[model samples]
Target: MTESLTIVRDDLTGAATRGLIAAHLAGMLANTPVESVHALDLTELQHPSVRVYSAWVGGEIAAVGAFKTFDTDRAELKSMRVADAFLGRGWGRAMLGHLEREARDAGIRSLWLETGSGPDFVAARRLYESAGFSYCPPFGDYSLDPLSVFMTRDLDPASESAGR
Candidate 1:
């Protein structure tokens, strides 16, 4: 907990970033059915609508989180993973909060995410809920499935009221 951490927007095409993403994808797939694994890969992360980030401590990657735009008012959290050694130390929470702030500043009023709904994902589910994300219908191209859980949170109270 004493190590300094830096989470910033990153390009995922780099070798190290690719390695981190591969590890993340492995975890996601291993924890859920292949059809339900919606985690993005290197090619998918290159889309113009997506922004990737990496958290660093002691000059090594600590975690990675991504922001994917859904039109102008909505964004989806993608590729959220903390290095195994960094788990349970609040890096994931910090990265999620950072991405939420980035999305809000970019004018995204709604933030959504899709994660596995299995015991392996308990910690991730807890992190999202504790950060104010709540269960919601499947988003984007996703459909309801017992293996997947979708959650969302309104980023701006003012916008939520304005829409009403």
Candidate 2:
């Protein structure tokens, strides 16, 4: 099953991809306050600084993930979601790994992310933690928010703790 999962850069023009992003945003809004919802919408994901990717299993979109590059060596993970029909099959972790590799190859030395702090985000937080992300202060234009959890990880290949 894993071999069939092909992840590719998305142009954000497909109906399935757009629908999945919408669902991701809706889920974020439903689980967290509007002010704390940081999931990028379709237009935002298409920004020049942002790169979106979609994982396809067979003909259906299994998951979507993206990152927004900051200054030179930093990027923020955004819009990560596994389709409801594809959850619990390790697709989320696969997508996370895919994004990490893409960022690293693009010269990104640090990967940051913000997710909800409520129960709804436990799995997401855990997935990040297991992938070497550690809790950190908010980065970029973000600030401290009780409903948000900020995390970051070094992507430098020479760093001993790149993924630990």
lDDT value for model 2: 0.90
Q: 20-124, model 1: which lDDT tens digit per residue? A: 999999987777778888999898998999999999997789999998998999999999999888888888888887887788888998899988888888999
lDDT of 2 by residue, 1-164 (tens): 54578899999999999999999998988888898888888888989999999999989999999999997889999999999999999889888888888888889999999998999999999999998899999888899999999999888665443233
Instruction: Determine which window of 10 residues in candidate 1 has minimal summed lDDT.
Output: 155-164
Per-model TM values vs. the true structure: 0.92, 0.94
lDDT of 2 at 118: 90
lDDT of each: 0.86, 0.90
Residue 46, model 2: lDDT of: 89
